[model samples]
Target: MRRSTLFLVAFFSLFILLNSDTRPDSTDTSKSVTQEKVLSHSDKTTTETEHHGAAPSPYMVIPFLLLLLLIAIAPLFFQHFWEHNYHRIAIFLGLIVTTYYATVLNDFVSLKHTLVEYLSFIALLSSLFVASGGILIKVDKKATPIVNTLFLLFGAVISNVIGTTGASMLLIRPFMRMNKDRIKSYHIIFFIFVVSNAGGALTPIGDPPLFLGFLKGVPFFWVVEQVWLIWIIAIALILAIFFMLDMNNKAGAKEDQQYSGKIEFKGLKNLGYLAIIIVSVFLDPAVMSWVPSLDPLPVGIREIIMFGVVFAAYKTADKNVLKANEFDFGPIKEVAYLFVGIFFTMIPALRVIADLAKENSDVFTSSLFYWATGALSSFLDNAPTYLNFMSAAMGKFGFDLNGGAAQTQLFLQNPDAIQYLTAISVGAVFFGAMTYIGNGPNFMVKSIAESAGVRVPTFIEYIIKYSLPILLPVYAVIWFFFFRG
Candidate 1:
């Protein structure tokens, strides 16, 4: 516990040093349109009439539907020798379908914010490395009373900064290796609970929905500030549970086993790659500065820094060291492959929600959309699910009070349109913790755990066992007691 406190204090100090601008700056809310911009007109009659027209988003869905049909047939027609990892394929497709549904409903979100939010999420990985590396500096394999505790704290801290997946990837192996001799090690499960999910609540990169929220409206830093409270509580609970499990195993520990220090961390140069990830995530808005008319100079600068830094990292990383770490393209590749179809397939779902957004105002504020989307995201793809909810909420804004009838004009220009938008942003991001498959890193971590021979829960089994029993209940508490208020 003492070690955990020191590590957390160190992590905070490092976080402040790196993230010099972690402030909750508000967003630009006023809808400023001009003659230069072409826009559809609406009547200020009723809320329904205020719509710009039947959601003009059918164009986006046709491509997605066609693609799905092709995906279904391509494998059969090609007789491709490629191995089909059925579970992975199932989860990937689920995300695509959910995204498509959300897109059709107009619940989609933007891309700019996702980029920036993800950058910070990556940069934070450096801090995890540094902190974990610190413990290795003084590692005494013989007496690791504080190792599990240190890992749990480090996992949570990193979850906030680098994201749950990065933290888990960086720390999980070291954790298992440290306790290799112990026969009673249930630390892995607790590791998954804290290292993988519970701790990653604060920032958007910490969880995908949070990033989606940033894409939608919520300030980047606000999530970290407000979510720290939840992260801390979850961290504490996970640690306590892990301690109990470890203690039970310790009771049956072998007397002859001796401490061994086989694990050593080298390649400080690769540490720079971790930094590149952070810069990329934080400066996403700055990176997109060169897009035609919208020259967000900061985004341009950020993009340059990310590409330049990471490129340098790739050059400097030792092949031997990377091989030792077992760093493969598998995780990122899986994310890329699955998300390709997902990003396109879900446009229809988003468009549909965008069309119905004005009428479903209650869905946003009441958080039915948030919980529902997040829970489903646990098994589906979180990104598309997030976009779906965001698109729907934003659609509500397209309703023009002037286009509505005299009887319903008051509701169209209620001047409170932005509130619902923010609600979608808040709910979707905050609620992604309800299941494992909800986020990209969740399954990746589970796969890693299984590789370690940790006996991970099956997909539906995970939902019924870990998620439904633990996550859903706690999330319910957080919603009604913390978020709803």
Candidate 2:
């Protein structure tokens, strides 16, 4: 984990240097911070909005973006001097940056007209939140290979309900406890594969991208329809791979580690928590908008909703449980911090891509476009990335807003919109496994596992070991056989 952190710092350092002029931080001499804030006439540092009406000068775009990137990452270097709740500084900075960028970038009018208001964004974040408690749990004594397999199954099953992170928090301690006697137990990696990533594919609530899809236009029950197929395929592959690997680990087998355990209904009985999740969704566009729908949530009800959740969580989850798992708000805070800068700084790229879609609609229709968008989405922000491709498809493919095909020249005269949408969706969701930043949960999973003392691979190492070797093949197989030729 430390190594991965170092690697990421280095990577971002390179990013800062290569895009030097665009860095947005406040310098010792320079009074202004690009995306972070701009001191207003009123003395309040306000959002550093981009020129969002239409296309700005091409020269302005790159320089402004570089300035924004610098502002975004500027905090990393200063924490050594001032260490009291410094992370919060980044969080607020992120909020300012994302807000400024989204508001100031080209075509705010179009974005406002099309996508739901800023409230929806907040709702989306709230909906994605999930967590659980974990105590040390040992496996059943005298258990065999079947026991290990069952443990994996149990954790995987819980993932969809409570989320990958939740299931990890709930079952990982016990999962590790059960296998504690073995010195070479690499079972934890398989746990991450099945319990963390694959398991989250079943429901919108299970992962952020899927949740984002549901909030957009994708149906709620669509994922449920594929439950068995996705789950079985993911689980089978993981089991087969893990079992084969375990068989090779003579050291683990040599230790006659006695283990015995039963399912704790605390995690299972809390199944009722899904109901709270449902209520939360209704609160999104359906109800929350009605309450104090006047001022922008950033300046109004957004704070109320944020406070509301904190109050509820404090009152609900047991203190011991929270403490045991060390349920700090760090992960979500990190999301809030990092993504704000990302959304703001990358508006240029997004607008550029959006313009590309507007100009060349055929690009969205081609198979090359689908895979390419998905592949790039593996590295970029999949949401805006998805939107860019979607916009292109909408303009060119000539489909209705529902993503249905146009009924003219052939079965579907213009298939660009739907094709692009599918490509973007699939790319954002599946290939996200390639890198940590692709999806919110990717790094969260790694950090959580490491917090539990697991040996997580470095950022580059993750791609080399797991993604390219294991995930890409499975995703490719699924894509070639089902999606494309």
Candidate 3:
């Protein structure tokens, strides 16, 4: 791990030294003009010149790419070491890029923004993780194909209400336990596809990417309003496919041998905690809007509320509930450590994309945004990728990145902007199913399945076997019907 970190530092440093603009005078004026043109649209008049000089060169993207490669390859090639040292690696990479930005580029504002974003993002994810861990749903039914499909469908519906992570945590155990005697790998894959990814397309609470969008001024319901049809179609098709596959598999085997029992939900009080988080999500922005004098940040208040609720749930919930669920902090800790690096190193890549969008806004049509965002989100973590494309899309339209409810309203009212936003929303959420690393819950589900003695596919096998043949075609249909049209 140390050798890898040193190699990464040396390589990124050399690359940045050789490629990044060392002098401020070398900054592209055309990019500056484009940036100014976009920021000019803000409701608040800016006396300060927008720092188009901070446009990152393509060289700065190396750290981001290297980080992504580390995430993708390290686990496959160096599983034991990667498992033990991922957090350290993440921190090292983050510091390397941040140091470059601070010393070489003299851009601390970007670093500050990135860090703040990381904190808020991790805080919310942590709160959700803690709170969700307290709830356990026990299943008492036969593992029939139809019943399994119905459970997945139910998971898909509640995914929007409780979030993909929350819903996955609550349901995966029961789903696994119900079919433990007769479960197959395909069942797990389908669960990750429909329950962990596609189901999260309809609401801000459903996915981290959408929640990031919400915090960045997108309306809470805008996701549903824009992509409900796509969500419904995708879920319907996947469920239908699963039903057929299960039926065919079941027909060849003898069933009704596994014992069944009645279903029961434990830690019912956690539901209230979950509701508090959701309500806080919707209401915090409004509260911020009402009381402009709030200190620190309104989001901080929301974070505090969520953390408090999480603590309450953790204390009030029974210990046996967590034991039955086999709950642990490993998944959330992994996400926390990994995403911090993603948020930080991705700063320059996001800036470059935004600058490029400004210079050539016409090139980034709705279709382009959808594919670009989704394709990247397929391998990279979806939350930061979503924010990156969102910034570029906003810059293309000369919209304010920080504009909240009013900007969302304007975006909804404009037909062209609506197309881009909808594309972005659907792409980030739906394509997250393409890979385990695409979303937090994907891997969590995989780990739990493995612990339960189910053989989950490797990264390459999963993509080649399931994602490409199944998800890509569905995405193509969405692109043609929605984005292109």
Best by lDDT: 3
TM-score of 1: 0.61
lDDT of each: 0.47, 0.49, 0.72
Tens digit of lDDT per residue, candidate 3, span 1-485? Answer: 45755654553454344334333233323334533333211111111112344566678778778878887778789989988988777777777787787788787445544544555555566666667778777677777788889999999989999888778877888888877767888899999999999998888889878876775667777888888898888888888888888887753224545444678887888878877877766544332444222222213456677768767777777899878766776776677667767766777776665565556666789998899889888866676667666666776666755454466567567788889888888888889999887887888788788877899888778899999988899889889889984
Runs in model 1 deviating more than 4 A are 1-146, 182-189, 215-217, 250-253, 256-264, 286-315, 350-358, 363-370, 380-436, 483-485
Q: What is the TM-score of each candidate against the true structure?
A: 0.61, 0.66, 0.82
**Candidate 3 or 1, higher lDDT:** 3
* Range of the 10 consecutive residues with the lowest summed lDDT in candidate 1: 39-48
Instruction: Sort by TM-score, best first.
Output: 3, 2, 1
Candidate 2 wrongly placed segments (more than 4 Å):
1-52, 56-131, 134-159, 162-171, 181-193, 223-235, 251-257, 265-274, 286-295, 299-307, 400-423
Model 3, which residues run further than 4 Å from truth? Answer: 1-53, 215-218, 251-261, 283-287, 290-299, 381-384, 387-404
Predicted candidate 1 versus true structure: per-residue lDDT over 1-485, tens digit per residue: 24533543442343233234322112211223431121111000011112232344455565555544444444455424322442244334434443343445332122222222233333333333332222222233642446678767877777777777667767766666566566232455556667676677677767655654453335567656655665565567556655655656653236786556555666665555665565455443322323222222112344455455544554556666555545554544444344444443443444455445546745565356546555545444455455555445444555332221221233323434333333344445434444443455555565555555666554455556655776566567656654462
Q: Weakest 10 consecutive residues, lDDT, candidate 3?
A: 40-49
